[model samples]
Target: MHTSDEIYHRVLWDPRFDPERFVMGIAERGAPPKRVALEDFVPGGEIPWHRVVFFEADGHVVWDRASGVDRVGEVVDGLVGPEPGDVLAVPAGHRTAVAWLPPDPLWAPIQHIRRAHDRQIRRWPPHVNVLFGFVPEGEFPRALPLVSAALAETPPFTARLAGVHWFAHREGTTVWLDPAAAGLEPWARLRESLELRFPLCGGRSHGFTPHLSLGRSPDPHPLVREAEALLAPMTARVTELVLLARRGDEPMRVRHRVHLGTGDVHHAAEPPPPGNPGPPPAV
Candidate 1:
């Protein structure tokens, strides 16, 4: 039978990007040898299942013990390889195994992740629009969630399934700001509609709430009165709604919905402009 140490050595020495060159030995004594593409054994439909090795890129293994039984049998031939307890290096992305099996083991982890993703989609609320908002310095404590709740009635047009999100501002808040620009026009209209509908207090500041970010603020009541008093007379327009996502340590704007509101009406006391560029780089 092949020793676990031997298998480990082979993986360490031959790791490479060329999926075809890599080879896995069944055992020391059993079956005729065989070779195949590494991708065939991946478990998941798109992402696939592979063991991640120590190498930066070349470390990955894909094998399905159940469906690939015939393939594995061909690779091992009839050799009485390592017993169930003997360890073997499958591939880099594959999960750790106590030992190598004569035939590969069925890939189960991929199925689990798929099921979880489906469940998350099913549980999501249909009406919620997931958006992120940054709390301007003075705006943090009171404005975040309150604004989010106020706009709960607005429906998400893009990802109708994912609920709106108002992530805390900081370094991470930039992700949502970029896409916000797209909804500026529609947001401006919405703001105008709101101003026309609600009694505006004098001297209060007013701003358009992008459909996605309507519910992002924590509690904006304190500022609401002041903002309303300042903004009642002036019109509010939103040119875009920024959709941001974390990329590495910084936030990146991943998506944008422009011209959300009807016509344009610039608001007074609009917060300083935010920084960041187009939809966050694709994953």
Candidate 2:
């Protein structure tokens, strides 16, 4: 059964978002719709989560757990009455990511390669993606403590760019620099811990391979050699894990920084509103 947090997550990031024209409510068939405190709403305690939960947009029920069986605009009737509390506040229209951001001079050389072939140079910094397509941006606040707890035991370390490599995609070839095994071991362990709380944030089809992407290239062999010469000798002091986000097609910006060893999280003093362009990374 879906919890109110899950429903709120859908409302914020799902394609059907329409705060101006949408309403969240509960009702039994033939009963009038009513607003209830989401925090106190217990599924299976009073009203079953799936049977009575519903969302309305533009005057019609767009989603109702009791879909085919219930009437067009109402949920299947539930047994108990509603409770109290404010609607959970959530930001909208952004996707989140977790990464290890290499600082300063490291960014310069990476960008040099990126400037020539990487289309995403401006979209993201020189980063080793630990988790991409992470929890929705609106949920970062809720996810922070869990992320901190998962990473508490993983101490910071120097990460070396051991070599350059390439991956062949259907469209083209992409070049990236590999992190040394010492770095990979800790990163892998941290990823394993995070997976317990966020199973969906794991790497793509082939599983995780820690690398800092140089960019996409039509002929990656020449770029790989050049990147190897320029970047393979570099080492980064990885003391913190950064959480970043972006709206559609916009450049990503840092939302928070989770320090390693101590597991302390640094929150943004004033976060940009959903859909607005955010400040550039301070790295």
Candidate 3:
């Protein structure tokens, strides 16, 4: 049996298949009849045209102009109940078409966050970006304090936002840190230590493993190398990730940290009751 998700996709692909109205089409930069494949039938006498298909769903065109060449224009128009400028291509079976639009802008907020951080860095003192290790489920409460204390004592710079993160140990790799169980914190000590010992160790947070970072510095290779050497001998359990944020914007600083604690415990502004609420009063 088709799962609901699969059925939804099918509907999105061809809503008309189920007699339910949907839209699909290809959007192009320039005018319609966007040239696609070319064929020479009689020494280029009006050149044979290739078929195109346009897919439409939810009243919007999702395919690009190149994709429109697949569906015979007439079929797409008919599927959408006809409209002007709906040119049809020969050999309808040869082409497929779909509605196309610009990519979604859901990531706008992230862009804003980046901009805000960039602006703040200009006024703040020097700092370094460091990736802390992950805290397994049910370990955040115990770990967060250790991380917090480290930052508090960390000389020169202070720890800022500690939030969950997703990162890869190597460059060009991607991983996700469960937001429900991740946290970030900014540490000043780490930053100053690196600067004093290895000035060149700045701005090299590109491909650090275990995938959590504090902030960017100039070149971090030497500092990271030294820190690893030192940490190897001791028990280095990362309880938090940190960054430097504006003092007035402390909440924003905390917003980015990943809480690796269990059951969304990191989100609670206040402590919960001794026991769970069994049920609601009768309505």
When superposed on Cα atoms, how far off is each prediction in RMSD? 24.3, 12.1, 22.0
TM-score of every candidate: 0.18, 0.63, 0.20
The reply for model 3, stretches above 4 Å from the true place, is 1-210, 214-217, 233-248, 251-267, 270-283
Ranking by TM-score: 2, 3, 1
The residue-by-residue lDDT of candidate 1 on 1-283, one tens digit each, is 2232323332232222233434442322255423323334233334212331111112222223333321211223222222231122222211110110010111122122223222222211101122222222232223222322223323332211121223455432211111233344433433332222121211114333332122223444432333233222212232233222222433232222222233121223221123311122223
Write one digit per residue (lDDT tens) for candidate 3, span 119-200.
Answer: 3322322112342212222333433443343334432222222233333344432211111122222233333322222212
Give lDDT tens digits, candidate 2, residues 179-204: 75455688887776565455445543
- Where does the lowest 10-residue lDDT sum fall in candidate 1? 95-104
What Cα-based lDDT does every candidate model obtain?
A: 0.25, 0.64, 0.27
* Backbone atom clashes (below 3 Å) for every candidate: 85, 1, 76
Comparison by TM-score, 1 against 3, better one: 3
Best candidate, lDDT-wise? 2
- Model 2 segments more than 4 A misplaced: 1-94, 181-183, 203-205, 269-283
Give stretches of model 1 more than 4 Å off: 1-221, 233-242, 252-283
Candidate 1 residue 113 C-alpha distance from true site, Å: 42
Candidate 3 local accuracy as lDDT?
Answer: 0.27
Model with the higher lDDT, candidate 2 or 3:
2
